[model samples]
Target chain A: MTAVLALLEFAPGTGATTGFRLVDPAQPHLTVTDLAATRGDGIFETARVVDGRVQALEAHLERLAQSARMLELPAPTLPLWRDAINAVAVALAAAGVADGSIKFVLTRGIEGGQVPTGWVLGLPSPDFTRERAEGIRIVLLDRGYRHDVAHTSPWLLAGAKTLSYAVNRAVLREAARRGADDALFVSSDGYLLEGAVSSLLLRVGSRLVTPRVDIGILAGTTQADVFNWAELQGFTTGYELLTPGDLATADAAWLVSSVRHAAPVRAVDGVERPIDAELTARINAALDGRID
Target chain B: MTAVLALLEFAPGTGATTGFRLVDPAQPHLTVTDLAATRGDGIFETARVVDGRVQALEAHLERLAQSARMLELPAPTLPLWRDAINAVAVALAAAGVADGSIKFVLTRGIEGGQVPTGWVLGLPSPDFTRERAEGIRIVLLDRGYRHDVAHTSPWLLAGAKTLSYAVNRAVLREAARRGADDALFVSSDGYLLEGAVSSLLLRVGSRLVTPRVDIGILAGTTQADVFNWAELQGFTTGYELLTPGDLATADAAWLVSSVRHAAPVRAVDGVERPIDAELTARINAALDGRID
Candidate 1:
């Protein structure tokens, strides 16, 4: 709504990036302050930008508000943020890329403040190989973050993306250090949580399953949408607690997210497995055959 | 060490002020970043400055590193950070304010890069209260931070100053909301963790006791130094797990920190009690009879 462009390298009104920028509450200025860069007090979302529209925008917006609530933050004004994001997408669209991932990060702005004003919008850095569709190797690592109320306690921002993501970054780094493409976070109790940047979805005997939300797993928007679409696609879906063994025995595995969509999990701990063609077909159908 | 000066109207390193400047890290230039106006982070410490020296500076350094570690950060180089702190202290001393508190804040720097880097520093603003020793009315709050993991997770950088301190700020606000001066954090299981900014110490019988490190309690430098001093004063000191009941029924209770070396807890949760005499004697003797 403000109609100011803080970052370039993308068109506006269509999400082509997987990043976000914060708006100053009082001014049109954008600043990266101590609130998030240092403390990681924020939330983020990644949604698809298809034909200048943020796909599943409402779900992403709702997730943002829920995340804010987990952090005990006042729910951000969705309409205003939407306008800001839309403006950036439109700008990016005009520049070149029309359809891509939109990364939105919301951080607690400034020092000593509770409300988040620090936001960033940008395309995700081009890192993941498009070959991920075939499958990617993921290594499991211990995050040491317990699932108790302190860490797992529901906050307006708990499931919401907060900027205190150093642990997530560290987890990813550790995974890479172990020669894996991505990291699967395991709770202190040895339960596989989720990937650092994506949600884990496994297919077992025609059932699409992921870890339950109560298991301290983030309520992933992409995974949720996939689940919803799965129901419509005549596939039985369930949310249940999962262990590595359960994942290992799955007919097929995949990590779901906004950018990667339904990238298949080809190998676990170097164990190669056959891809589940039927499940992939349903997921691709759910994506409307767009990911390629 | 980059020498720096803060222009403030109130006591040198105490209360929050509207704005302050730091000697620019890139050059000798001075730039003002108003932390008070920002409220970006919470729970800062200003240690005792004695005769152009920061008392137990290494301990404070250790605490700062520990805090950073808890927040899962790349440890700020001790010598460089210490140099900056000492520079500010030297500037303050030149302005003739030594033998007071040396302020330290762990704040997120300016935001905006893929990883933002905008750290700032300043001396205390006005309104700093230096009371020799005052009985404090304390309240206990449920911070939801795991007292065990939050208290003693070895990896969490416990006892270190971190920037994800909104909870600490919230605890103080909760205390103020309840008409208390400060707040104490208890685990979900009811173990007294520590004060919002300081560590907890109590005397059970003739032994000075605090929670052990593994209880998720912060390893308090001030308390540690006091324990060492207690040995000199012929008092047996031990660090063990403490619960609220243990605190309430203790022979005496005191909050230990850099500024408030040992403030007797007179009334906890409106249950008034007498001050612990032996605790006071050891504290006073440790301070060489000069508390204020």
Candidate 2:
């Protein structure tokens, strides 16, 4: 079993001194009525942490705020989250977790309480060296929504990062059952949306391409950072509607995310695709940095 | 704030005596790593309790089993759930809750633990007298899926009653913002699907109609029971593809669920619709019975 290394809980108006508490990871710490647990009524973010420092802290915080807004939640400010993240990161480091993951969660609180529950959890990162070095086999699954659904249906919460990820988890399970390592969701109309847990990126000639987020996909923060860094390295980026055929014909493809960084996709639906080791290393190098 | 009236925890292998424990509602009782809270990965059922007896107990249990199977969970046996439900229902009644609700929840459990967390929660039922007697105003909202989406994609959890209810809650909030009592979801192709929290039913001339469940909507247990009763009363029930205009022109329409039973639709999108008080009374009478 993967152990929860450290945890910190924060409730609004409790103040830093009394609100945050270091809790035993093995013990139960939430009420059964919490909406997050009962109804998946919440939002969350997971980021990579190294040597007590969190990577892309500002970006993760910004996305968390945006998700809170989309859910109509009164999100705790960035500084409050910063304090909680820093506290968890320090505790994890002191517990000897060098390279790990930090999760920021904001739940709708207990049923009808009208107060939000916020917390930070730190755990040792899963070793993705095999996926990063050997690459992964992915299957194409239909997400059952048209690309234009998000634009017209805001209540569907197309792009917001909510905790209602049962579908995403189910897709991954189905992929595993089909002998695939991961799954990339295709819209009902055959347009590529995103991976279950990461964003899809492809290299077509000199330009790097990704699916447009306006089509009801969560905007990948890691993909955004990589694109910005790639642009600085003289690479152009484009957001286009991609299809499975486009992915199969691309020079290279990768699943980009905050914790896993960039994992090369060696095959799509059992058909072998090109794996660009040079491009993979370049992307990882761009993401390599220390957070203060 | 709505207070949790009663709760009972049940885990497999603990036996009936050890497994069922009446818990204080105000305390924190779940681990922070519980997948139900973190990922909304679970299944739930809410049934009405009248005069210390649960209504439609067998039907709710069957649907709960179905949902658990869909989510790949190891569901507790019907006898076990019956024991827990009976225990909680008795305690709630002892606490003077005559007309209440009993909720059965089974979560994916704590991260890496692989054990399912099952519990029964008892709360006072919200009074729906006005909505039942005076009727409710509703609006049409797009569910962002085609009617055929469920047939092709089982991983989307089309008919499974999962805990990822963020979208449902969001739609209700949007409806409140628009000054409507509730919202009924329409498919991307303009077919009426179901309500966020209930099932849609309408009467057209001598025939009663509802959207087919194959279109990725949870099959409402109450709706099914009502249909069976209506059929016994010589009302023909037809599962057909319905549009917004069909609802507007219907002789009578209703949003039915276990707790609310059958609520008449007074209007849709601010346009008045016909309501059949006689039909509504008959439907309520059909559900007026106590469980053994």
User: By TM-score, who's the top model here?
Assistant: 2
Model 2: pairs clashing at backbone N, Cα or C within 3 Å: A37-B37
lDDT: worst 10-residue window of model 2 chain A: A9-18
The B-chain TM-score of model 1 reads 0.74
* Candidate 2 lDDT tens digits, B216-236: 888888888888888888889
TM-score of chain B of 2: 0.93
Q: List candidate 2 segments past 4 Å from native.
A: A1-19, A290-292, B1-18, B290-292
**For each candidate, what is the lDDT?**
0.59, 0.83
- Chain A TM-score of model 2 versus the true structure? 0.93
For model 1, how does the per-residue alpha-carbon lDDT over B156-210 read when each residue is reduced to its tens digit?
Answer: 3345555545455556656776677777877656678888777888877668888
Per-residue lDDT tens digits of candidate 2, residues A255-291?
9988888999998888988799888987887776735
